[model samples]
Structure formats: structure tokens, C-alpha cells
Target: MIIVNGDIVAQGSQFGLKDVEVVTATVDLEEVRSYRAAISRGLQAATSDARYQRIQTPFELAPEDDDADIEKRPTLPMQPRMHPVEEEIALSGGCYLWDYLRRSGTAGYLVPLSGGIDSCATAVIVYSMCRIVMDAVEEENQQVIEDVKRLCQYSQGVLPKTPQELCNQIFTTIYMGMKKQSSRDTRQRAKELAEAIGSHHVNLDIDEVYEAQKKLVVNTLNFEPRFEVEGGSNQENLTLQCLQARIRMVTAYEFGQILPTARGRPGGGSLLVLGSANVGESLRGYLTKYDCSSADINPIGSIDKADLKRFIAWAEKEFDLPCLHEFLTAVPTAELEPITENYVQSDEADMGMTYEELTTFGRLRKLNKLGPFAMFQRLVHDWSIDRKHVEGDTAPHYTPAQVAEKVKRFFHFYAINRHKMTTLTPALHCNDYSPDDNRFDLRPFLYPNFWKSWSFKRIDMELKKIEKKRASKGK
Candidate 1:
């Protein structure tokens, strides 16, 4: 029912109202977004009358009311203001999985659990799915029970007994580690986490597979590549690392396609594979194309690293999974490089930027829609030590030259690796800014380096001005 304002009678002809079917009163479309808050205020205003006649549309909600309309509007009780979406991000993620499972009729879910927080957060979300399923069953939600019985292939009178049992029935976690690159601590952490979550777990060393994959190039080029720690060049190091990373994707699909039959689940089917690449890494383009980032669906693709860590901490206490605390303290690593006494590969070190910085850069570029010059302009003051624009600021201290250099470096890596985003797995939408090119982010995979652009050249011009200004101030 479209409500047209009584005063705007002549203006109603402009909207082509025939297709709309109902145009009783007119409204300001701009105010529609705040309609919820307005309803709260209306309820507060009408607290005395018990027969609360709720206004159906914004057209009926006028700040000042005349006698005729006020007589028709019943008063409602004033209530405490509250938002129903406080836990929407985390809870809605689980709901996304459940919705997909029932609609698609997938047997369950499979995750390439790498013993990192990204994958760990994915596992925790699956556990939350189990919690949601059990809660539905306990509450006797008939529709959910019917769907559960069909998915689990349970006979009449049999129902899910616990979240752990439901998890084991629906979730499978595989840790594909290499003897040389994967460490004992990460391997053990994956095992402990799976046990805590009650997922069907598989653990194996893929050193043999890693070596065999390398032979494709080794046999063709008559070359044996080694990691950086093993005296290999940067090109050779990256080649070997990608070999290990891609192997995980191949293994995940192979297991996902056949796990139902192997487990004797009655119907032969496949599980929806989960990807764990966080938004910060996706933005930095710090992932290999078609590596483990390729999956049936990604839960953390849009969620940033800092928020993912906070979610993990929140899940540890809320879900009672003590094993998650270790992931919080553990250093973030790709674990593609060999673990050594002298060298442990850090994710931030490999990418040449921290996750926090990536978050800031991503927001400035996408959310703020700032290009190279504009981003440098914003960050110069934001990250400047001397010019603390906001008091009690904790941003990293950097000179204008340093800020400009960092900006150029980030856009360089971001531009070069953008091709990877074109294939980034479709992730759950939890964040405002995401570089998942396939879904939320839509941009060209190929482009000239932003450093060469006119806006970028202005950074150097700006830096020279700042330097000259500082030199004169010293006099």
C-alpha cells in the first residue's frame, strides 16, 4: 500500500504511479532508511494508549500531527530501544551455511583447516552451525527437523543427540601438511582443534605429493628448485611455495568428492568445500590463484583480519572451545616455507605489510574511494607522528616520504596480484569493503600500475613541497 501525502496531490503524477498499484500518500524516499528509528520514536510518543495502531508506512509518520490524524492513531507503550542485529554478522554466517545446505542438498561441509586463524574461524563457524541445528531440534522446529532428517539420512525416531554428534555427521576437516614446510606445533594445533569441535578429522604429510608436483617443471626444465632458506632465488622460492599451496586445493576437492561414500553415509554425495582467505589478505593480493582460496564457498572472504581475530576470541569464550585461544596467540604464517631455526615465514613479512595497514588502505581505496594521490593525502596526516590530527591516536608514525613510499608499494602489490581476486571464492558478506572480484568487488584484473598514473605522480610532487616547507620552517 503506497501512502501519498495529502498535500502533494499534484506532484503524484510525476512518479508513473500506475505500475505501483497503491499510492495513498507521498513520502520522502531519503528518509526510508531511518524508518525503523522513526517507528521507535512513534511508539515512545504513543505510550499512553493501549490499542496501538502502528503506522504502516513513512507517509503516515509525520513529526507534527493534526487533530483528524491524531484521533485515528492509537498510542503504544514506550519501550527500551534495542537493535536485533547485535550478533548478526557471526550468527548470520552460520545461517548462510544452513540455508545453502538445505537448498542445495549438499551432504555436509569440508574445510582445508591449515591450523591458522582464518581456517580456525571457519571451523568455529561450522561448530556454531551445529549449535544452531541442535537448538532448532530442541525447540521442535518441524521444518528444520524434516530437513535435518533428510540431510543426515536418519530413520524415524532417530534425531541429532548433540552438537558434537551433529558436527561429526556434517563436517569434515583435513590438514594437508608437508613434513618440510609444516611444523609440529601447527600440525598438533589442527588436530586439537578438530577434536575440540568434534569434526571428522584427517591428518597427513603431503611431502611426497609436494615433491611429485615439483617434478612437472623439474623434468621439463632439468632444474631442481629450492626454498630461499635452501639457497634458491626468489623465483625458485615462489615456484616451490605455490606447488605446496596448490596441492592443498587438489587434495580438498578429491576428498570432498569422495568422503560421503568412504564414510558409508548411505547416499553418495559431495560436501561444500569452505575457503578461509580473509578480506585483508584478499585485498593485498597475498594469495595464489586457484590455491586453497578456491572453494565452493568462503566464510571469511569479506571479514578482515583484525575482526576475524576478535571473532575467534569471542567464539572461544562464547562457544567454550578452549583450543581456539592458541590460534589467537600463534603467529600468522602461510607455512608454505620450510620451518627453520634461522627462518620462520611470517605472513606480514612475506606480504611486506601488516594486516592492520591493509585494512586501512582497503578502506581508503574502496570505502573512501580515494585513488593514489588522495590516499597518500589522507594517510600522510593519519600516520604522521608530528601532525597528530586526532589526540590519543595510535596509528604508526611515518614521515610524508615514508607514507608515500608505503602507499606506492601497496598499490604495486595490489595491482599486480589483482588477477587473483577475479577468482576469489564467493565469501560471506560480513564487511563493507571486500576485494572479492567475482561477487562484491567488480573491477578489471589487468591494469597499468597506479604508480605510473597522473594521480600517483602527484605524490612525488607533494612530498617535494612538504620537504621544502619543513626546510623553511627550520630557519
Candidate 2:
């Protein structure tokens, strides 16, 4: 007797049913060419939008065009100073933390300074708050206050040390991404900012650890339409995961271990003073879920990226840190990977787009005015459907209700993976809004499901039209 085994799964979903000609027939040479062209157009549009979103320049200004005359134009006072009351409130969070640390009998803050805008701002705030605590303790324990003051004086050199430490770990990454592209000397600039802030500096070389952790992190991502590292492979997924894990581990090491030892304490305070803003929530989420996960307090949690930049500029004038200008001069990057290496593979050498392409489409849909979040959920819904279509198990469409079920399943899969962020603390919990600190609340899951339902309602109508066409053709 002969028996057939169904257990032998093929390496790729698209390649599994090689005997099915229809599945293979989707990619004609012309179709591939058009798809590539559409991708190029889409990329151009998205990047153009991002560039316009960044600058003091108008949307009409060409990115490469010289506007020397515009540079000479008198800069208006775009940001007004905060009211005295508002300023007092603005400075209160740091004060609150300083008192918390003092009462707890902790030695001092162990800041994992990255020397980026957020971390730079954080280190300065911590330094200022310590000063306040020293003042409070001045009359009671002059010796301890003086010790704290002397420590702060020694640590004043640390501000510049933050950038240097960051450089030691990812200087090659910064060079490839920033140095090669522009004449703007970012390292010198970051160094200058560090000096202006009067903080002690230390350089740590974490390259080997980062590389080793990258592999471990990649291996942990079990769910996927996965890719193998190969010739001309962009390694984007690896790059992103590596970047996230490195940030998480580096912050954890600096705060959880080194800081306590440095301060001669068992552990640190309840609040870690995260410097995140709201505008870059998506980017922040990507970075925070990785690097900034170790924080207990996020001072700017409510501020948007736009408002945060405004506040930084305001601080530059108020604090007299000329390095603030230089700090602002450097382009913002998470320092996750080299720029020459495509963060997401733009090459369309294959018939089907890579996983990066799918994710980009999903992300772009979420950002576009046509309803970015809804579009993102819809695309994810379609990825599974497209996979099924390509397998020839189903025609290229599903009912509205069916699509909703698939979206729900996709999210359900991710929810099981929520254990990924469970170890980290969330930054803030607003009275109206839940803290984004990944505290594993039931709410975040609820919105994705709602969006998924909306997506099915919108797309199923179109899919039904496609389905009917196939049904009629069977005659």
C-alpha cells in the first residue's frame, strides 16, 4: 500500500504549487515592469512628502535648489517664550523626580545618554534637577550637597561624553549615513554640544555586542512570510530588529546596571525620564519598543515632535548652549544601520515584492491622507489573501466579512507576540489616553480590531466585484 504525506511544506508559499500554472502566470515581464514603475512613483511621492515635512522651507522649494537668498532672509521669532507659570510647570517634572530620588536615598541618575535631541534634552534636565536637589539639601547636609555638587561638576563633562559613547558604538553607521552625504561635520557638532552642556563623557564600543544581539533578535522573530539572508539581500528586517534590540539592551545596561554601580546604590528611581515626543509616534514607537524601553519617566511624553523641536529651539536661546545649533544641524537617525545599505530594499528584482515592500506599502497607507491606519490594516488583510490567491487555493478576492476575519486573525497572531514588549515600561498614562509604555493593556488591541473591521467594510465591496468576474468566466 502507498501513502501520500501532506507534511512536506515547501520553502515558499508562492513556489509551493509549482504544478499550478495560474499562480505562476501572475508575473508577466510587462506586469513586473509596471509594478516596478508604480513602486518608483510611490517612493518618490512618499519621500518628497517627508522632505517637505522636515524643513523651514516651503513645499514649492526644490530640495536641491540653492536658496542662498532665502538663507539670508531675516528669521522671524517663530517660537514665543512660555509664560512664567507655564515655565514653572515645564520645569516641575524634573523637580518632582529629583525629590523622588532624594527621598528614596538614591545616589544620582544613571542616564544612558545617546546625545540625540531626546537624550541630550534628558541629560540636561537631569543635571538641572540635581542642582535643584542640591540646593534643597544645602542647609541640612552641606557635605552631601557639596559631594553631589562635586559629582555634578565631574559629570558635567558627561554631556559631551554621551555623543562620544554613541559614536564609539555606531560611528561607522553615522559616518555612512550622515558624513558621506553632506559637508556638515556632525561629530564635531555633537562634540561641541556635549561640551556646551558641561557633562562628563565616556565612549563605549558596543559593536560586537550589537552584532551578536542582532542575530539573536532576528532568530526570535518566528512569525512571518520570512526571508533568508542571501546575495543582494538588504537585511532590512535584521537591520530594524538589530536597531531596536541594541537600543533596548544599551539603555538597560546603562541604567539598570552601570548607573546603580556608579551611584553606589542597589537600583535607581521609579522614573527613568524618557525624552520622547508624540509627533514621531510611529518612529518613536519603533525606536522606543527597542532602545528607550528601559525608561521609568518620559518628561516630554505629551509633546508632539513639532512642539518638541520648538521647545528645543526655545531652550537653545534660554540656556546659552550654542551647541544646540550644532545639535539641531545633525540629521536625526536611530543609528540602526548604514545608509548605503537600503533600510528597506527598493530593488524590484523579484516577481513578488519582498516582505519589506509589503510593510512599506502598509506604512505608507497608514500615513497617506486617504486614511493611513485603515489602509495599513487593509493591506495586511490583503497580504494573506494575496498569498492564498497566488497559491491557487482561492481566487483573488474575499467577502467583506471574510476579509474582516482574516484581519482579525493577523492581529491575533501579533497579540500573541505582545510578550515581546511586556518587559518594558510605558512612558505616560493620560487621564484620557492610556500610556504608550507597552504595559499590555487591553485597549491598544481594541483599536487595531476596529480599524480592521473598517478596512474589510471598505475593501470587500471591491473584492466582490473581482470575485463575480471569476465566477462568470467559469461559464
Best by lDDT: 1
> Each candidate's TM vs. the true structure?
0.81, 0.46
lDDT of each: 0.80, 0.41
List where candidate 1 sits over 4 angstroms from the true fold: 1-86, 154-157, 387-392, 436-443
Mind giving the per-residue lDDT tens digits that candidate 2 earns over 201-319?
44344555545555675578752322223222346545544564455445444544444345433333322334343323332133335555345555545333433455566667766
Q: Mind giving the per-residue lDDT tens digits that candidate 1 earns over 370-463?
A: 9888999999888886864677766888888889988998888888887777788887776568653554445667768787889788999999
Give the TM-score (vs. native) of candidate 1.
0.81
Q: Candidate 2 has what TM-score?
A: 0.46
Query: Superposing all C-alpha atoms, what RMSD in Å does each candidate have to the true structure?
Result: 9.8, 25.7
